[model samples]
Target: MSLYFFARSLVYVIFKPLYRIKITGLEHFPKEGAVLLCSNHIDNFDPPVVGITSPRKVHFMAKAEAFKLPILGKLLPDLGAFPVRRGMSDREALRVGLKILKEGNVLGLFPEGTRSRNGELGQGLSGAGFFALRSDALIVPCAIIGPYKAFRSLKVVYGKPVNIDELRARKASADETTELIMKEIQNLLEKNR
Candidate 1:
């Protein structure tokens, strides 16, 4: 197996049981071509949880600070993670994300931009929508529930892919697209709750 797959397997083996992890709606993910996985961020564990559970290899936009660490800096790129500067536009990060999508890979994004400290779904940022529009990739709304507590059941629900062409035809603004994504995520969370 490749290093990325090996690492993901190790993570899944170790954490899945501890968290009682469950994932649903895999049929909604595209079998080929570019796709984006937009999820709500509740904690740092969300990324690995989503990545390991996904049927496809998922490239994530990690913070630039994490890439600065000596060991992780070298390991992250191999594991399909690229760095992005938080709280800034960071055009390079956007470029990397688009490039991954254009190459027909899955890109994992947390539209909220940052973790919600209060366990509440926050407003989404426009980056996810922007990348989807730019790359013409399908956006799959994902909801990750119950990762805040160790030894508790954690659930991940993937909603149906949002139609980028329909949204584009409507002349949807970035904010509008973001809101739509967030609403889908919220709906999934509510259903699971």
Candidate 2:
């Protein structure tokens, strides 16, 4: 945990200034315990953008390809990121996510599954919905706006917690829950615009 703080702090110190990032709703982050941070995908920098701006160190999911480079493959794990194969079931990725929640750490996820090359908000996959339902972790719906714009002040608006119990009680189907979560993320992003 100390190492996670060290690495994240070091990067935050360097990047926050370099990027001139601006963020809001950081007060919404729980001061202690685990949280699932679900955010929109915009650029390749989205993960680090949220990681650095976040009040807590975020253990974000990174695509397997980022770790294909030998040195990074070894280093990313230490930085609290694990890889997920793009097209596979990725049980390992899911396990890590659940374990992180179980261990009481912030698990950041881009609900869109991948970066949006066109800078448009994309549909969120079921990964976030499933993880939230399984772990009962507090899901913080987040929006990252303007990070894709170079030299612009990036805004991140975090919405109130998503209640999984309501979903279960409502007996929402898999697709329904995913679409609901995506819509919440989309609405937050739209508000930031």
Candidate 3:
């Protein structure tokens, strides 16, 4: 936890000025307890940017490759981040995310699974939706409007939380739930764009 806060503080101080990030809807974040941030991926910097901009500690899921570097691997987990295999069914990543939620901490997910090459929305892979359904955590839908647009200050808007009861009634399985959640998240992103 110390390392997480320390790293978070560093990022908050260092890159925030460089990015000139603008964030709204911070009040939607719960003051305490479990929460999930479901965001659209636009660049490799998204996770760290979101983590730093957030007011609370956020456990972000990163590709396994990033963890291969010994120093980064050791530092990342301590800094409230974890690794998930990119192209495989990584049960471990899912378990880690669930554990974070169970512990009443925030879990950050890029529903699209990776950075967008064309700066457009990618298919949300369902991880965020499945996690939300299983953990009964608040899903905070967020969108980054100008991530790929060069040299421009990026705007990240956090939408209102999705009601879990309403989401569960529409789906019988994790995949279905994921699809619905993605659609909801995508709609917000498109509208804001």
Candidate 2: tens digits of C-alpha lDDT, residues 1-193: 5666777778778766666677878777887787989988887777777877777878988888889898888888887898888877899999989999998889998888888887788888888877877776788888988754545577778888776788877766766777777888888877888
- Candidate 1 residue-wise lDDT, 62-123, digit = tens: 99999999999999999999999999899999999999999999999999999999878999
Ranking the candidates on lDDT from highest down gives: 1, 2, 3
What are the Cα lDDT values of the candidates? 0.90, 0.81, 0.80
Candidate 3 has a TM-score of: 0.89
Candidate RMSDs in Å, in order, are 1.1, 1.9, 2.0
Ten-residue segment with the worst summed lDDT in candidate 1? 163-172
- How many backbone collisions does model 2 have? 0
In order of appearance, the predictions have TM-scores of: 0.96, 0.90, 0.89
lDDT of 3 by residue, 1-193 (tens): 4987777778778666767778888988888889988887887778777887777888998878878898998788787778898888899999999999999999988888877888877777767778988896888888877753444678787888877786577656766666766776677777776
Residue 105's C-alpha lDDT in candidate 3? 90
Give me the runs in candidate 3 sitting further than 4 Å from their true place.
Answer: 148-151, 169-171
Residue 123's lDDT within candidate 2 is 81
Give the winner by TM-score.
1
* Candidate 2 off by > 4 Å: 1-3
* Top-lDDT structure, candidate number: 1
Using TM-score as the measure, name the better of candidate 1 and candidate 2: 1
Lowest summed-lDDT stretch of 10 residues in model 3? 144-153
Candidate 2 weakest lDDT stretch, 10 residues: 147-156
